[model samples]
Target: MNNDVVVIGAGPAGMAAAIQASSLGLKALVLDEQPAPGGQRFRAIEQRYRRLRAAGKGLPASEQKGLDLIRRFRESDTRFVDQASVWDISPGGRQISYLHHGRSFTIPANAVVAAPGAYERPVPLEGWHLPGVMSAGAAQTMLKMSGHPVKGRIVLLGCGPLLLLTARQLSNAGANVVGLLQTTGPADFLRATPYLPAALRSATLLKQGLQLLTQTPLVPKVFSLTQASIIGADHVEGVNYRSRGGSGFIECDAVLLHFGVIPNTQLSRLAGVAHDWNEQQECWQPVVDAWQETSAENLMVAGDGGGILGDEAAEMSGRLSILRIAHRLGRISDQSLSKLAAPLQRGLKRLAAARALIDTIFHTPETMLIPSGDTVVCRCEEVTAAEIAAANASGASGLRHLKVQTRVGMGPCRAQMCSMAAMAMITPGIRCGQRPPPPATVRAPIRPLTIGQLAEADVEI
Candidate 1:
């Protein structure tokens, strides 16, 4: 009972989980790599949005929700370790092992919650390695958080709710949104609409998209997106494409391209938790039951790390996980269990409805974003997209063979920069392995420390 209950990530979902655990009178420790908590989402909102909110912070509903989240974490009691990157997780001799502080140690937590949120999945395409192309999520964060807006007349590529919405945000923020690429045709609504019955829970999401399109009718259309390749010698100067109906090039300085996100399951895979391929979402998610318990009873997963359930659902899931943890520890009576679950279950239902609508209009990666014959698939190792094609050309198809043929996945960054590109080259039907980041390779401290600092650290702490 006297062990650290570690929560990875301090994003909205992880924050909610930590607060719930502490409120239940449990000892918990949160580990995050960032100097500040608030994963990328609220972290970005904290920027210009905060200045805008300072005028009438509580007025705008969206900005207000963001503000409230920041205030809550600021007031929580969970112990936080910033700049502490959790590199690996494994079953620790009846406990869980965490590689932190550049050392491997295990904590005996009766419970553990993995709340690692989502990261932008790799966007593979022809000439995607050209300097000017980047994922929409990365561009958004750079502007919102770092105050470095992705400049120039940007061609916002990829199709999904995210792409459209991001275009609006960029346009609002004064970037020239030259083109909004659509991977799916208008017939996509017809082809995928049949899934709507199962997806109607997300009506608010569908409404939101309709509203955005209504507000800004000038969004750019597909600028030669079918099997298109961005062309440039050292930087992306333009995109050339031949759709079924048309062919042309859309010149641009930058291209903000991205599909939907995959689960940030690096730790889950490293921990050897059971995972299954979800073709639809195109990423691995942890296997959890009704209570968010993983295949291993002591381990639990919550939030987008659990799967792509959106933020509100993630908050509710965190609360639900806490309830289950309390119940398992006998902190609550059986009679009270029913009373607790009813409202929580109802809330999840509403979130489910909202999620359905989002799934429909959300971005789906077009073949243009995936690798083609001429593209250099690996950017970090500088493996040309053509070499990957040469391998695939000879029936040396699939990501494994592609990797074997070209040493794309063997660099120091260790596939972090190349795995998704390989997958993008292959068909969706092929199997892919989780490219979990190897433990942080520590280096000498920035400021050369004297024996005095080490001796002082030992003496003081």
Candidate 2:
């Protein structure tokens, strides 16, 4: 029940941290919600490769590095608990309570690494709640894990690297990609020229971006789209988008929307870690030191969960966190830690520069951030944009007031689905100078558990 360290998540960051910690002689246990490791980026990679190879499909270069990382992680002595849903962590990051195999257990730990990754920023649009509509990341998960191709013609809407990557992955998987609609244009990339050198410093990342941009099979890709809407009732029938050429419609079976990704900060928030908003990324992030330690002693957060950096940065952050933890445990010398931290610090700076460029190039379009008056913002509560606007007009101050008056964030998702949109409506101009507000309060039982399961809990203090 006791360990030197407990790492939450099995993604690149978590795996890297746990492997490093274990190799340093720390008793590290890695817990992940997925039945397999690799997180979303490498979701079910091993099984997917086997299935694809059996079907005469070769592994895509996009997934090669991740596969190698996962392989190395698996070879490590780190203990892994797959499908372990961590619900809460005790004060000071000493213990964690998680549900595994229908049982609850509280494991004590000296240090905790929270590597919960990021999720797509939910962009609301007309008819977005209809069937056949999903986040672009979800579509990629389906394809990556089970080789489940999207049924019928699909339209990819919105911006970010994920959209382009998903489009390419789907097309390569034989899905009929109807269209690729982007909210940002060449102007956005041109605007990011000053940061281009930093972004291009990593040849691998530059090559990946080039491949995704050029490899998509969809033709006539539209850019600078505005007033994009999903036109369907019970199911997705088609998509409506506007550009300089005026409005147009694309008949498709489904619409995959993704503006960008925001860190998954619920767990860190629940752990009472101090967080601040990243104005450029427009998301909440845990306040971490250069060593990746959070304000709460012994608690570390890495990966996209801490911010919106890409996988490479996440891996480096994870290693940096583990190195710090290892040094704290006397597993590594101070001199060694200092030497190790230097390179990670440099890598993080380069990555930060690159991320700034990426964020600018694919900044979530203002139109997407602020949905139309009639658009459904909170799909779970069936709350519309007008309703939230009415609440704000009636003197609602911020996300808390809006949530109380309009029940916008009280749904099953607990604000994950609608918090960003509601916050945007309240603060129309979110910039750096403005003091960033903390995220909504996160209570215990972060993930839903049945009443009966809770009653049967066997967690020890």
Candidate 3:
């Protein structure tokens, strides 16, 4: 199985990259873990909408751009393999290994596009491990992928555009949105004003955000919440919080929490690509060159996986990446490549300006740095904040040390859920003013793979 290019992830970026590569007369293969082509943002939109209508629910407005891109990619000569997970990229990144339906196989590629996407930033809190608590992305997945809404009163908690948007979605879906707990305040808005003009370039997005924030029917809107503690034993019965007005409590059947998103860097890191700490976003971003190529030659990281610049930018970045690859492969002239890339680069810059405003406006509240006393920090390992503090007191002053001391990040999810929390606890220079600590170390099998599967893997020369 040799190919001209192999694009990992079938989202906006991967799909675009494969299509563009194929258009340039290169054989491109797209491998994705989803049963369908759309990533989380556009997850199962076409089929799920029909399911929604059959259940007597109105079809939510779909992402037309994503659907159109999917159609074009499907119609192209490129090959797409879904329900496949790439577990490793061999030395020099010229070979790819993946597992599908209990079988493992390997392929050779001239170039690889790693458009692996992003995930919601996890903020652990008291009772966050409760049965009814989930991330805002999870809630939206339920609403979009299935027509499932919260069974009873639901509360939207924390900050970010996703919080407000999910609140509106749930409200519009006829779910009982009991309240909205917002961490960001007017001061944050004032701070973000300088970047507002650039962000407002997309008037449609600006209007949609405003409507979601101001017109959502959720009641008892709580703003500038300093601290939120989920209160329940067997399950979440309500949430308690502190605000300028004093302490408050609200009863709810479920709580959807979000604090923006960070790149899903596990696989990229495992590949030993160079990474740097992004202070503004407070996460490690894979170091990519102007063409979205990483330090590793012929390996590219695009889309939210490179950095969380939104879906449109992801699509543009994908097309730009493969065009560069096409030029490198001598399929296109340098003059033609430059003609194509110049505009995409400028568009990404404008989108970056808009993203600065969004990041500033929805900045992570300081109170969410680490969980409160006794809060569960690692759901996979059932590790608590108190235990982490105990390890810290015993001289666990780094992520690796903390992991060894408390086994917080040595779980099945490979620290995806708790590494950030551990880093926050152990990162030095918090009191003094210095860059945050590096991300947790990533090792291969970036995702869990069975030994039997490894033994059965067939590699084609």
Candidate 4:
């Protein structure tokens, strides 16, 4: 099959890109792994909206916006493939191979938009592998999908706006949110003060943020937490935490951790695009031009997958990415492209300013990034920080070398959960004049695929 554009994801960026492509008379196809569109932010938005409306409850502004976007996407002429696991894209970004409904298929496209979205930063503390431990985002996802809050006593830990927001949402859903432990303290807020002038431009967002902080259910809250460890024998029983004030243990059935989100750069890396380390955000992101075109020709990355710019900016970026594709396809002239993109770029700039403050206020603490001792950095392979340190000490030179020595990034997740932590451990030991270690190489079959599925693939060529 061939398409003018192949969009990988159905989130804000992918849906918006497809909508823009359709508007420009381009043949666009969106491949999303979910059963429906609306990626993570709007996961099950259509279903949830119907349920909430049936119950006569008012939809939150965010959900309403997502519903509007999803509705627009559904009404657009663009094609959508749900439950489509896009396992690989050719290095040049012209060919995409995906598995849908247990059958594999390949599609050729003139341009590809990658908006796989972001994932929570992995924080591997002792006992984090316990059964009841999950990311705050995961809790929100469950609530969004099933319309039920997590059961049992919940202890929300780590930093980020999502942490506060999830706590409030869960509490409102009748979950017992017993404790909120935040790594962000007064020092982080002090650092963020300088960005307030720019952030003030988006007063509505700031107000919503303030409401989250104040409206969260009154619970045992700890700020500026220096360290934390989940305590359990088989399942999560409680969390022990240390902060500027002192130490305490929160007895809870569940521990929800959030250290903010980072770009899901695996596909971009797999596509052989150049990437740069974002020190401020503490993650690797694909190098994209002003129009969201990536280092590789005809390939673009948008949404949080490019970087953590929030959902609204993601929609703008999604639309911006398609403008270049449309121009290249002769659907729009250069002047037309520029005219259409001007407003989106301006909106992105405004959102970026507000993001600067959010990023500063919720910067992941250094201690959490570089775990030591017996902390398991690679949960999939059960690789420990001490083992990684040992490998580095034994002359494991770079990321690939360390992987060879400790099998850290060779797990089923392909280092999605552990690569950043592993990179942090490996970077500091580099000898002078030696080239810095490159990111772990991503290969084909990015997602798990059975041999039967491959054998049954229907090749269009």
Q: Write one digit per residue (lDDT tens) for candidate 4, span 313-358.
A: 8999999999988888788998998899999999889888899999
Writing each residue's lDDT as its tens digit, candidate 1 over 294-365 gives 887767788888888777777777777777777778776677766776777676777665555455545354
lDDT values, one for every candidate: 0.66, 0.86, 0.85, 0.88
Off by over 4 Å in 3: 51-62, 202-204, 428-433
Q: Ten-residue segment with the worst summed lDDT in candidate 4?
A: 428-437
Tens-digit per-residue lDDT, 1-461, candidate 2:
56788999999899889878867888889999999989988888899888878989877776778888898888898889999999888766887889999888777778899999999999889999999999999999888767778889899999999999889889877899989999878788899899888888877777877787788775558888877888887799999888755789999999999998999998888888788878888888889999889999889999999988888888889989989888888889989998988999899888887788889988767777787578999988999999999998899878888888988988889899988888888777675365534567778788778888888888665
- Top lDDT model: 4
Output the lDDT of residue 334, model 4: 82
Cα lDDT tens digits for candidate 3, 90-136: 65477888888879988887888999999999989888889899998
**For model 2, how many clashes?**
0
User: RMSD of model 2, in Å?
Assistant: 1.6
lDDT of 3 at 165: 81
- Which segments of model 4 are wrong by more than 4 Å? 428-436
Q: Which stretches of candidate 1 lie over 4 Å from their true place?
A: 1-4, 47-49, 54-59, 92-108, 216-219, 349-357, 360-366, 389-402, 424-461
lDDT of 3: 0.85
Which rank order by lDDT, best down to worst? Answer: 4, 2, 3, 1
Candidate 4 lDDT (Cα, 0 to 1): 0.88
